[model samples]
Every structure is written in C-alpha cells, then in structure tokens.
Target: MDTPQNTALMRALTELPGPLPARGVIHIAIRHTDRFTVVSNDLAQHPTLSTVAVGLAVRIQSLPQGTEIGIKALAARFPEGEKLIAAALRELEAHGYLQRARTRLPNGRIVTRTVFCNQPAALLRTRVAAARPQQPPAPPQAPALPDVQQEQAPEAPAPQDHAPFVALVPPPTAPRQPSPPLPQPRELTAELDRAATALLSDLRRHASQLVLSESDVRQLAPAVAAWLERDTHPDTIRHTLTNDLPQPLRHPAKLLKHRLTVLLPPPLPGADDLAAPARPRIAVTPFQTCDGCERAFRAPTPGHCRDCRNAHGPAQAAAA
Candidate 1:
C-alpha cells in the first residue's frame, strides 16, 4: 500500500481540483452497453428546430415500428398538450426528420404511414443517387513494378512501337433532357392570376414540403389558375397537391408542376346538352278499378282488391 506507485497516485489526486469550475456544465459520461439510443449531432444540436421537436424526434427514433406517435398518443405519454405535440410533429416533417403518407389499404381503409429519418441528409443523398443514371466504372490499371525490379531486369525488351499504350477513356455521359413545359392556362384574368399566386404561396402553410421559391411560384401560377378556371375548389387543389406526398420530397415545384398538368380537371360544360344528363324520374303505377269489388287500387292491370280476394276465398271455402 505504501509503494512508490501508490504514493505518486495519491500525490496526483491531491494536486487535482476537488471540484470542477463553478461555471459551465460537466458531463460524467458512462459507457452504456444497452438500452441507449444513438442520436446524431445534426438532430441533438439542431440549429433550427425547437427543443421539443428535437426531443420528440429522439423519442420517436428510439421507439419500435408500429408504435403510436400521433399527437394524441404523445400528448397522453408526455406532459405536453396535444397542440404542442402536433406542432412539434409538423416541425419534424418540415425539417425532413419525419414524413407522413396517407395510403389506402386493399380493404378501402385509409391509414397514415409515418417514416422517421435519423439522418435526413444521408437519406436524401441516397435517394438522389438512386434516381441518377448509373455509369459504367472505368477499368482498373495494372500497378507499376518497383524501381529495384526494373533495375534488375534492365535487359527486358521495351514495349514495341506497334504495341503503343492507349489510354482507357470513359464513355461520354448523355446530356440530361429538359422537362416538357407545363400546359398553359386559359386566358387569365387579373383576379384569377392573383388567386393562383396566393394559392401557390400559401401551400407551405398546409404542407411544408411544398414551400416554393418566388420564381417557382411565378412559373406555376398559370397552371393553378387553370384548375381554378375549371371550378375546382381551392381546398380540393390543396388536398391533391399535398396529400400522399413522397418522403424526402426533393423537388416540390417539379411535383406540383406534374400534378397540375396531368391532374387538371376537364373544363366546365359550355352547353346544356354537353352537361351530364339529369337523373331519370321514377314512374308510379296508375290506380285502376278492381274488377271483383269495383274498388280503386294501384295495379298494372285490372285485378281484385285484397278485401274482395279475402271475402271470395272464405265464400268459396264455405261452399266447398
């Protein structure tokens, strides 16, 4: 116990401060072997997200799949209210940490499918790479021999003029073709143009993935006006654009442009004849005089009334 090593350790312990500085936080780190979630610095020290949102994301990432993380479920579990939980979820979605898609089952039931990304940036890169066309890799070249080997084999014949080395060049990549132009709207009015612009700008409020740049809004405004011209309600337009959105939506403007072009409603009928036919009216049976009792009753042909039929049946039975 009184060895030189023990004495040195005791001296070192005494030299160290009894307590850490009275300022900043000190972490007593532990090596956890189990039941610990690994959170990335991007999320743990998020510059833009609120504390609630970051914490919520961590909690969600730790949970198993199919666990309920809905606003109601989270509100029940945590001290936060439903409103706060809902806002935090929206924040996560906006920042690419969460995505919710409404999918219809084979049984015609609609359910919300949620996907959480711990590394949103990595996921985005993966998606982009997958979407890009794959190019053939260049062939590997043989390694050069060491200088010592060359010196030892100085008598070896050099490459002949006929066998001149040719460099291996990669094939040229095809240029990306420009996307086809979006269909133009019918003659736009001042009011229609303003409404369309407003709708495009306001899309972010409903779905944050749809936040468009000013230039994008200007470009896509006419297509939206076309929808309005077809008498499509604003709510309908919003739902169609925002619902069932793909996770990690890389190009919102492009997606919106495609939907506006392809999903455009047919123009309202111009003439009465062009409109859908009116529903057929039901025909009522005509009232006819019963042959047996001279009673008025509904029938396709002259027939005995129920009372007359019953009376005749009893009389016939009595006679029999």
Candidate 2:
C-alpha cells in the first residue's frame, strides 16, 4: 500500500488549500525519525518526489498558524501507520530532498522560527510562481495596431430614402483558425491535478502564515485550477490534481463533493451564476460618468475611460 510519507503527503495534498507559509509551526510527524526531510529534486528524476514536493507545499499553508508537533504524529495521521512515511522520507533525503524547520531553543524552552533548512534557492522562483495568483492570458485578440481606432468613421449618408436607409453592416472578419477542442471531464481532471501540485510548492514558499479562511481558500482555488485546466503539458493535469485536491477535501467525500465538486475548471464556474455578473445597462451612482457624454461608466482597466479621462492628461472641463 502507500507509505507513511506518501500517506502524509497525500493528506497534505488533498486536504490543504494553497501553499505552506514560512510562519507557523510545520510538523513533519514522521514515525521513523524527525531528523529526516521529505523532498523531491528534478536531478534525481523521481516522479513521486515531484508529486510529494507539490503536495507538501500546498498543505503547509493551510495548516493552522502556530500548530506544532513532530515527525511521529504526522506519520500516524494517515493509514498504514508509519511504513511509507519512513521509506519515502529516507529516499527523499538520500536524493538531497529537504524541508523547512522552526526550531525551539537549544533547551526546548521556546519555539523559535529558526531559518529554513535545505530550501534550495535555485528552485524558489518557480515554486513561488506556481502558487501565486496567475492572471489568465487574455484571449488572443486582433494584434494592437498603435493607431487603430475603435470607432470607424460613419459611412457618408447614402442618398436614398428620405429618412435615410441605414446600410446593413457585415461583421468584421478576423483570421479564421479553429480552436482546440475543450478537454473532456477526465482530461480536465488530470490537468488540474498537476497544476494543483505545482501551486502547492509555491504556496509553501510564499505564505507568511498558516490557516487560510474558507473565503480565502475559495479565492485561491480558481487561480490554482485555472493553472491546471488550461495548461497544455502532458503531465500537468495529474500533478496538479495530485497536489491540490485530497488534502483540502480531507473532509468526508460526501461533504467534499457537496462543498467542492471539482478541483479544476477554475476559469469556469461551478455554480450556475458566476463572474462579475452582467454589467448593468444603467450605471449606478457609485460609478463615475463621462464629463463629455454623461454616459455613466466603469473603465475596463483601472485608470479611466478614453472620452472621460485621458491617460496622459486631465479630464477636459465639461458638463457633469
């Protein structure tokens, strides 16, 4: 069956949401030895190593801040007792895999967050990126031509009907290229799994404290899942799911299924209603209005509307 380290890693992977922040007492809880570290490295080229690394990163943060313990408890937390935990952790240590530590005073008088141990600097940036918020690549659009105008000149009025015959306009054409098919549910599942793992590693590195709230958990899920769902890598799905799920949903399957049906598809909404909701046709009072046209508005970007406020300069004095 699965090893204790594997079991611990799995628990961390499935139940935890986001990364393990440097703060908070992270407990390895190995039944074998507290001295051992569980880690995975690319050079060693162990697939399971990578999976474990991803899982650890994700779970570390979700652990409640200030929770403290040791190797034995962690090993016992999962099934199969401590066998897998011992085996896996030893294997990781042999290959230069490592973990962080917050040591107590030499006498064990007080818990002190001693500097991290065995954290490889070279791998850090990548871990951070995986866990951090990722803005989805904007859908490919017409390449920006510096002076291209959104508003084309109104066609000269055609002399015909008295009122004026409005010419039917054809939609503008873009280069036609078929998009790839949406992945099947299974495909989506695997992709998300890998992304989840990667994000876990990053979360562990970046988070300052453990214990994220439910809203906070929900906030990070979409970004993490989006990283998985839309990724093109072959192993991406499995790794992401392996890392992200299992831990956060440590709740009974029924509860987990009811709470979170899926781990991937963050870009897509689980609930029927989602996203910024339809922009109201009529702007609300809190929103600003264009001084020139009096059209109440919210600009797509943070700064301002083109007609109302110029990026380079001030809004032209006009009727409010």
Candidate 3:
C-alpha cells in the first residue's frame, strides 16, 4: 500500500515562528538552532516585514528540499492564508532571503524559479550557483537482455549553446514623480501689517506687562503670521502671550518676541501630505488619457479631449 501523507509533518512545518521570541509566554519548547543564520538589525527590524513575513521566512527555512512549495498550496496550510503568505514571500525576497529568477534550461526552455537561502548569500556566490548546471544521475546497468530484439535506450536531447544567466526579479518601479512645487503664498502687505499691529495692541490691554509700541507690532506681525502658519490659532497666541506674566512691568515686548521666535511650532502639512498614501500604492487604470489635453478621460480609442472632439468631431468622422 502507498504510504499515507504525514499530517503531523505538515502541521509542524506550517507552524514555525520567526527569529524573534514570542511575548508573555513561558515556552515548553523553542525553535532553537545552533546553525541559524544571523540577520542584520536593519533586516530584522525592517518596517516592511511584519509578523506574517517572519513566519513565512521561518517556514521556508524549516521545510525540506523538493517540498511542494507555492503560494496557493502554502496558503491552505497556514492560518493567515495565501494573500498574507504571498505578501510575506515578496517581503522575504526583497530582504535577501529569497530571489526569483527566470532561467533558460539546456533544453532551450525558460522557467521561472525562486532561489532560497537560509543566510544572506553574496551576489557572486548566488550567480555562480544559479549558473552551475545540474547533471542527471547515471542510470544503473540493466540485466543482460536476450540478444533477440533488445531495444537501445533513447538518446537524450543535445544541450543548447551556453548563455549567461540573467536575474529576472522585477526592476525597481519608477520613483513617484514628486508633487508639483507649491506656489508661494501671497506676500504680506501694509494692510495685513496694520492688522497684525492691532492684534498685538489689543494684547497689551489684557496684560499691563505686554508693552508693545506701533513699531514693535510691524516687526512682530511677520512673526505672528509664522505662528499662524504653524497652526496656532490667533486667540491661542493672544492667551499664551497675555495669560502668563511676571508681576513687574518690564520689557515685555522683548519677552513676547522671544516666545514667538523661540517657541514657534512646526509648520502644518500641505495638500500633498493629505493626498499621499501611507504605503506604496500602485494602481492600474483602464481609462485612457485625452490625446489633445493629455489628461485622463473616458474613451474607447483614438482618445481626444471633449473640447477637441466637440470642435473637430471624431477622427473617424473627420476621415470619412
């Protein structure tokens, strides 16, 4: 009878943890190895590699050679399933644990395969290993056959001409075109300068210590505008300047100016900050861009802007 598949082996293989220790548990057994690969702090704590990635790495390391390893098959065996496993595998490949390459065989067939490494191997070593040809094992001699009608073994296909191996990992994607530079905000003017003067003048009445002359306000207006740019409300600035004070009347203008300049908060994020995605976001759109306007617009083919189409009519109609 054919041997039954080992369910226990499958379970043990799927449930391995990463290099990190689990929290808040006294371990009955630890997945310890004397010959385990030592990873760098940067690789171990990489932001892209999550717990799912760690588990996948561990699983890949523990599995025996020639085991049926694929995203679909591994997904069924793990709790996190295929999507997580696939993502984790990609993470592992990115971090030097695995490399996917499309290689041409001696038979002129191209196959995509992943090279797994328990430790980070040098690029030269990896290339050399991948380039090295794997030879078929020698066949055992058969018992002497009868002279009558003994058939000769079929000849193996001739090996193709040698070619250099090429790594087929997807190229690094194009960097995000930086957001268009922001237009400078309008420059401060005399009217706005007067408004700032009024703001500081009003503050002196609240606290006798806040002594600011008209000249001081003109100098201080730009600083106040900077505070506003940092997201400090006008009322809050007033309260901060007037509420806390030394009892004696002194050079309060200098003190207030010092607070404004020294304690300035960080600038608020711009429109781009809100628009940007938290992680690398890639999207493929079906809509084509308008030929005339060069902006994305709905179209079947020979895409033209609405204005161009309306004015010139469809290219087909124009041609006809």
Candidate 4:
C-alpha cells in the first residue's frame, strides 16, 4: 500500500493539469462591515416579481427614511426610465412590499407618506395587530390590610334617594366627515383612452407647472376620456386643463381632475337617434292613368309621370 509507484499516481491525480475551467456561477462573497442591507429571501427570490422590481425594492429598503423614491427621482438615478420604474414601484405595492398614503398636514398641505416593508410578512403582521381589538388594563389593586385591621374596618354606606347623583360623561370628540366620492368616467374605447392619455401626458408642453407623474396620467386618463366621449376636442381639454394657471400650483393633477369633472359638457343632441338604426324609408307613390296614352304611371299626386310630363307640351300641361 505504501509503494512508491502508488504514491506517485495518487499525487498526479490530486494535482491540476492547468487552471480549472470556469463552470456555472461561482460566488466570492465579501462580508460587509458597513453600508450593507439585509434583504429577506422571500423578497430577493420572489416568484412573481421581475428582476427590476426586486432590485428596486432592495434599493428602497436601503435608503434612509424620507428619501425621495418618486418615479422621476428614481428614473434620474437609474437607467430604467420612468415607465419601468413606475411599473416596478406598482409591482412592489401590489405585492405588499410598499405602501403610499396621501395625508393632509395641519398646515392644509397634502403630502404622500411612503412606507417600505423589508419583509411582506411583517407588513401583514402590522395590519393584523392594528385591526385587533385591545383589552383594557386591569384596575390597580388595593393593598391588603392586616387580618385584624381588615375585620375592624367600617362598612361603606349605600347612596340614598335624597342624595344628588352626577353622571361621568366622556368628553366629546370631533366627528369625521366622509370625503365625497371621486368622479367616475364613462366607458371608453381603446382609441379614446389613448387619445386621453396622450392629452394628459402632453399637458406639460403647454404649461410646465402641469407636469404629472405616470400614475397621475393613469388616474386622470379616464376622466379625460369621459370628456372625449362627449365629443370634447383635445385642444379644448388641453386649454381647460392648462388655462388660468395658479401661481406656484402645488398639485396639478388635482386641479386638472376638478376642472375635467366640473366642466364636462353634455352629449350632443340627437346623439342617441344617430346611434340607433335608422328606419328604412318606403316611397308610397300613387298610380295614375295618363289621359294622353291611357298608360298607368307612378306619381306623388294624381299627375303624369316624368316621361308623360316631358312629352306633353308646356301649354298642354299647364291647361291640364
């Protein structure tokens, strides 16, 4: 077993003939000592998310709170463009990895609050906890007295009918009024929808202040389509949305939405009649016998047909 030839053969088998050929994928992982993010495998290897979405989610999780993750900002930072970035954000939101809520501050300014969840399960747990009913805390217990002292304590007296009673009423809270329902758009065809979307997207060309995000375009597209459905011109829509610009307009989309809803024109008159199938018209011509040749001919009234009238002289026709 310890023969020289056997030892030589084992050394040859263990030694490489050259550098090993690269195969599949190999990872030379480096442990991060700083500026590293911890992402859940559930998110990193999500079955339904695209690669772009996963990367975006990871980027969002690594950022500090209050960091701007808007579509425009992300598009500027990355090469994916606004549409793709917006789609990725939507994917994250749909999968419960992100949440954006619009809140009105005490200063009467509306702002969006974004919440990012590293683990979707954590988000679900938060929602469940918030929805659960909370039990009241137990009242403080009275200290126990000595056995002999407790037996000698005086008994409490009950209230009499002559004594005045006061009810413990809770302080009144401000009532919350429900927000009015948003305007709904009429049914739209593909062409109409495209036209509406294009119009909304092109608003910035007319007024730079009217620049809208991709999501704003989508949300307002239907309202624009409703205007188009009523035969409103694109120029009219653009003018209505862009005219009388407010100085330092904070929310263009909201202003546009209000204008589109409030200024919507009624459908053209006889539009239903035009859409309905027209009744087939039938000519009810009366048959007449010509006195000249005793030939039957069709006429609106008791008169000769075109040929008979032409053949007859002008004077004779007038006399007849």
| Candidate maximizing TM-score | 1
- Candidate 4 residues lying further than 4 Å off, grouped into runs, are 1-23, 126-320
Question: For model 1, what is the alpha-carbon lDDT of residue 141?
Answer: 98
Give one digit per residue, the lDDT tens place, for model 4 in 90-131. Answer: 999999788876654554345777878676675455556555
Q: What would the TM-scores of all predictions be?
A: 0.40, 0.19, 0.28, 0.36
Candidate 1 C-alpha lDDT tens digits along 1-320: 56998787666655665675768854445589999999989999999999999999999988988998888888888899999999999999999888887655654345787888787776666556656989999999998767864455556788674422222222234476677677677788999899999999999999988989999998999888889988899999999888878778999998899778767777877798687989999999999898887989988888888888888998999999
Residue 149 lDDT, candidate 2, scale 0-100: 56
Task: Indicate the worst ten consecutive residues by lDDT in candidate 3.
Answer: 177-186
Q: Which residue runs does candidate 2 get wrong by more than 4 Å? A: 1-61, 90-97, 100-320
Scored by Cα lDDT, where does model 2 land? 0.44
TM match of model 4 to true structure? 0.36
lDDT of 3 at 141: 90
* Model 4, CA-based lDDT: 0.77
Error of 4 at 7 (Å): 33
- Candidate 3, 285-317: lDDT as tens digits: 468778778877766665777887786776668
* Residue-level lDDT for 276 in candidate 2: 58
**What are the C-alpha RMSDs, in order, of all predicted structures?**
15.4, 38.0, 26.7, 30.6
- Residue-by-residue lDDT tens digits, candidate 2, 23-129: 87655443756444444354334455554534433333334555432346545554424655555445444444443333324332334331122334334444555
lDDT of each: 0.83, 0.44, 0.66, 0.77
